[model samples]
Target: MGPELPAALRAAVEALLEGASRKDLARRSAQVSNTYRGGGSSATAIVEDADATAYVLSRLPATYAAVAAALDEVRVAAPDFAPASLLDAGAGPGGASWAALEAWPRIAEARLLDASPVFLETARRLAAAGPAALAGAEMRRGDLTQPGEGWRAADLVVTSYALAEIPSERLEAAVRGLWAACAGVLVIVEPGTPAGTARVLAARELAMREGAMVLAPCAHQQACPLAAPDWCHFAQRLPRGRDHRLAKGADAPFEDEKHAYVALARPDVCRAAPAARVLSPPRAGKPGLEFRLCTPGGIERRFVARRDRAAYAAHRRLRWGDRVEDA
Candidate 1:
């Protein structure tokens, strides 16, 4: 509980639920009969929006915890980074942005860029609700493909679950441009799917090329689960009537499907080459362990030996160059 967090924030949520019964929220949402069905919001995306908000609001106290953790990881990796303002890409109804704000109170101003007017309106409403700092935010209508001058200014940048939607050709360039604009840090989040994983991989590569470092989910390269025909989406369940039945219909307990990508931005920082050193035999009853290569990047990257053979082979283990796990 940060001292800056207002007491009204909790009060508002409590009041919001008081008027709309959780059961009603669930029933209407489940029925797939929202009044906004024929409206401009994407049929596929509204349920997503409803379920996402409901789930985050329901159980995840400070649902931004994951986002905050990612940001903290970045802070640990790069202690000199800080931001007074932010530019958020694909600011889907401002959910992740709010999460980021919770993690980084140092940011006082923000600008949300997205292609949806409905999303912008929702962002406005959410901002007005309790996050007083959000009052400094403004919305933009374009994206990486045709972003206007409005997208170019910021101390921090965030691309949360918005990059995969961008065309393949523009992905790298967009990442570079985003880093180029960052005065402090950049955080990118996608889903845990194969396609999402692939996009995250590409983003990591692009970020490294531009001098940024990986701060979380340390494994940058991983197998994509969605590369095949199988579905690769995560589900977030929403309880009944805890949501806006007018917006969600009778679908009491609904589920939100999503792919996520979370990454951090820093000035191009690279780890040094691995130091080559010989290992000594263990004493007494200690199990024989050998072939440990240390890197100048400062991580005790260890390798288990198999009959004097290391799983990673006899190689220089750079801090991050050696693929150990997912980031």
Candidate 2:
């Protein structure tokens, strides 16, 4: 099955509708969407309790799915990484923390940091029924752009879809602060748009310069092989719950959240990196399967013809964002 919100989290989010007006939720949901579309941040959009609820109902599921998908890559790259603590920066409704808890059950402590009081409050309510670790997480108010010594260190640090809010001048410093607090691994996730890819690439470069190892999506720390017109990204298709569909007024039962992410680890904690990662879906034909992969050697297009039965069979099962043993 594809990535999904944990049952507890899904139920908690759905329960939020018990006393809410559907009309207000839909209108506020649209406002939040428009604000983001117009380059505004959640700090400006989520000003009240209703706005926060609307955001949770409309966004929590997709956010959880995207972060979970990214964490799956981390699991593959470093199988032995059993984190005991997590720091969710710019945590909106604590979705990334929930995803981390689901990915690594060993996580016993979590801290969620966000600037919006409304989002932090909403996150607290949603997390009340979540995993024990997340339910007791520390919710702190802070600006990601000005991260300082006040931030606590953790084994797993994640900043999902939050970097876009930092101004260009302060982005590198924000990334640096996050790296400083990362005792083990740091994962940054963004929307899959070209602009989002640019932000991820920038953060990836900054982290690498500070001695961080590229753990996923890239086999080598060298410059991203894909040029501008073409960027690296992946999609996670999540099943929408009834409240989710109604909040957004959408008929589709599922939504595809396209995201671009970079997972980095302190050099000492880096484990077995993948030989290659499938950059896009493989093309299957009667003749063979063509795969575009990111390998240590660089971006390569490899063709496995049906004649190579073993390799073809092994590759046929691979999909976009999957790790490959050979490229």
lDDT winner among the candidates? 2
Q: Which stretches of candidate 2 lie over 4 Å from their true place?
A: none
Candidate 1, residue 101: lDDT: 72
Q: Give the Å shift of residue 280 in candidate 2.
A: 1.4
Task: Give a tens-digit lDDT track for model 1, residues 199-219.
Answer: 776777777776666554442
How many residue pairs clash in all the candidates, one count each? Answer: 41, 0
Error of 2 at 201 (Å): 1.0
Q: How high a TM-score does candidate 2 get?
A: 0.96
For candidate 2, give the lDDT of residue 121. Answer: 92
C-alpha displacement of 28 in model 2, angstroms?
A: 1.6
Q: What TM-score, computed on C-alpha atoms, does each candidate reach?
A: 0.59, 0.96
